[model samples]
Target: MKHIRNFCIIAHIDHGKSTLADRLLEYTNTITQREAQEQLLDNMDLERERGITIKSHAIQMNYKYNGEDYVLNLIDTPGHVDFSYEVSRSIAACEGALLIVDASQGIQAQTISNLYLALEHDLTIIPILNKMDLPGAMPEEVKDQIIDLIGCERDEIIPASGKTGMGVYDILAAIIERVAAPVGDPQAPLQALIFDSVFNPFRGIIAYFKVVNGEIRKNDKVKFVATAKEYFADEVGILKLQPSPRDVVKTGDVGYIISGIKEAREVKVGDTITHTARPCSEAIQGFEEVKPMVFAGIYPVDTEDFEELREAMHKLQLNDASIVFEPESSAALGFGFRCGFLGMLHMEIIQERLEREFDMTVITTVPNVSYKAYTTKGDEIIVNNPSELPDPSKLDFVEEPYIKANIITKSEYVGPVMSLCIQKRGVIVNQHYLTSDRVELVFEMPMGEIVFDFYDKLKTISKGYASFDYHQIGYKQSDLVKMDIMLNGEQVDALSSLIHRSNAYEFGKKICEKLRELIPRQQFDIAIQASIGAKIIARENVRALRKDVTAKCYGGDISRKRKLLEKQKKGKKRMRQVGNVEIPQSAFMAVLKLD
Candidate 1:
């Protein structure tokens, strides 16, 4: 057990977490030269193209240090705030973490938050200064920032360049000397925490877990404590570059288990796996369940594909456990599932994955956050969709979810950043200077405000120098109203949203204008209106396609031309009554671009 050191890499976005992992793998001789590539741990094509880690990857490595062999279990984690849940699960299975900071960029918001997560788990942190090979690298400035943040000594922080492989050996030496090995009794009942899992069409669901006690052998009959389902371990193996099957995976080791379980729900992440005959006294305490930050509806383009969509979602959920969904139906979109996501980026990635991986074409509604609606009778209802909110006559008040936002940026952009937050109905809670030029501003802002374009605008305003992170701070009462978009006289429930009263009129106006441009002009005029209950806040009209009815009467009498015009007008009116405007898919997505 002393020879096994389990640890993970945590950092802000684009701070070289995967690059550093590649160097570590190369130095430990875990992957041969032919197997190495950039962001080697990131196997997803989406991850490589976007230059970010969307999922946590686990791999085992063998190293020889001080003439003694050592086994290292490394899990690489994503840095985006939307995927913090991934980082938490990775941290739960490790004893230590490598906190990598970009020397050129100094400390950012995600770096601080990820560090706090590791500290909360009581994991030993080894700070490393990455990107030292860059020309603008400020090793001393970044070193001091790390010292002040984590309260570690100056020399303890290692300055390494991931690109050139500098200080790679030093990082390996630190992991071996500093990270403690897993501590568990081999005789104790089997208890393993399932951190992640993936589905296979040919095989079955493959679950990756870390053994907390005892051992799991091939062909052992095991049961999941959460589900109470039993299955025979058809295959057991340790994770190498590829899964290497083993007869036994003992205590303090991480490995995969395959029992030919075809169902995705049978193996849940964070569930405990134990021997069916001699199960552990209780299930192991795992990470908390993920709370999605955004709620949206996903319906199949073809209604008959609903069941296939459900199965695809189940399999996708096994891979990305952060997704939460339940069946729902809408008047305009028909049957669909109300899905919860971490943020806008996370939601977009899931939408793309659904189309690409499962070949499921889906239509997503406007994303919103869950709201608390209290009624006159003092009954509180949790509303995830605007259509679910009670009428204003019966409602007492509405509360929206708020978050404590942390933003780190250069001192000069403080003014613009503060103004942007305040414009979004945010209140500055506190402000502190992290360094002479780097400022950290804390604000309490409604979660709904940032669901749309706040992140993009912040990046643009700060010129991509600022980093932002946030966590939910519960709900607060606000003057919010439900706004619905009306095509003709009918309301499109899928486009409804709960928005603050102050910005309702302007937001409605923008949506009306955007839809006018996207909605094609038919033979009949289309009335695009945004309303709050009985009041119309904004309205626009897509003019009807005019016909040259008087072309044959070019030299006719004025009465003849007028009669022909009148006849055409009557036909258009009749057409308007029976015509059904088909709201294009682009119109649904246009709501998100009404900047």
Candidate 2:
């Protein structure tokens, strides 16, 4: 056990976490040079295209240090705030973490967020300065920032460039020297923590876990503490780029168990596995069920494909336990599922995977956060959809979820960024200068206000120089009201949204204008309006598609032409009164993009 090192890499997005993992794989000979590629640990194509890690991956490496063979288990984690839960779970599975900071961009919001998480896990942190090869690299300055933030000495921080493989070997050596090995008793009853799992058609559900006590061997019957289901281990192995069969997984080691369970949902992440015959006294602590923070309605573009969509979601959920969904229906969009996600990026990844992997076309409603609605009788209920909110007459007050937002950016962009946050109903909490040029600003804001397009706008306002991160603080009492959209004097429930009363007018006006541009002109005039209950705050008119009704009578008398024109005008008036305006799918989607 002393020769084993269990650690993970944690950093902000684009801070060379994946690249460093690739270098480590190559150094340890886990993968041949001919087969190695960029971002080796990132298995999803969407991750490669977006240049971000969405899922946490674990791999085993065999290294030789000072003529002694050392086994290193490295887990690569997502750096985005949306996957902070994933990062936390990965941290719990390891004894130490490599805190990577960009040499050019010193510390970021996610860096601070991840550092706090690592500290909470009580993991030994080895700060590493990455991207030192860049022309703007300021290793010395970043070193000072790390020392100030974590109170570590200067020499303890490692400086290296992941792109050039500089200091890669030294970083590996540091891992062996600084990271403590896993401590467990091989004689104790079996107990393991399932950090991640995936479904396979041939092999069933493969659970990736770290052995906390005793040992696991082939054909051992293990029971999941949460589900209380037992299954014989059909296979036992470690990830050497791919799963390779092993005789047994000893204590303080990481490996996988292929239980004959066919369903992915059977083996839940954060669940404990114990030997069925020689079971442990109790399950492990620090296990948290994944809770989704964002909710949206996903509907098949073709109503007939509803079953296919459900099947796809079921298969996807087997691999991703963080997703939660149930049957939902809308008058405008018909039958669908109300799905919950950790954040917007997680929601987007699931949607893309469904479309690309399952070949299903889906339309998603605007993402929303859960709200607390208080009734007149003192009953409190959770509302995930705006249309589901109870009538104002029966409600005492509404409370919305708030978050503590942290923003790190160049000092020059502070004014614009602060103005943008203020516009989003954010209250400044604290501010500090990280260095001569970088500033850190903290604010308290409603999660609903920023779930849509706050990140995109922040990047734009800061000229792509700002890094933002946030966590849910709690619910706060707010003067919020639901606004509904009306088309031809009929309410559209899917277009309803909850917004603060102060910004109702502007939000309604912007949405009305956007809908007008998206909705195609009909044969009769169409009136699109935004209303709160019966009171209309903003309206837009889409003029009717007029034709030359008198063209055929051009060669005839002027009186005839005037008569035809009058007839056409009367026809339009009748159509306006009786015709039902048909809205396209694009209009519904366009409204979702309105910031």
Put down candidate 1 lDDT per residue, 1-595, tens digits, no spaces.
Answer: 9999999999989999999999999998999899988899999889988999999999999999999999999999998888989999999899999999999998876787788899998999999999999999999989988998899999999999899999999999999999989999999999999999999898899999999999999999999999999999999999999999999999999999999999888988999999999999999898887877667899998999999999999999999999999998877777999998877789889988899899999999997878999999999999988988998999999999999999998899999999999999999999999889889999999999987778868877987657777899899999999999999988989899999999999999999999999999999999999999999999999999998988888775799999999999999999999999988878877788688
Candidate 2 residues 340-417, lDDT tens each? 887667877888999888898888887777899999999999987788788989989999999999999989999999
- Compared to the true structure, candidate 1 yields what TM-score? 0.85
Off by over 4 Å in 1: 369-383, 389-480, 520-525, 542-579
Instruction: For model 1, state the Cα shift of residue 64 in Å.
Output: 2.4
lDDT of 1: 0.92
Measured on C-alpha atoms, candidate 2 has an lDDT of: 0.87
Off by over 4 Å in 2: 288-292, 302-311, 369-384, 389-480, 520-526, 542-593
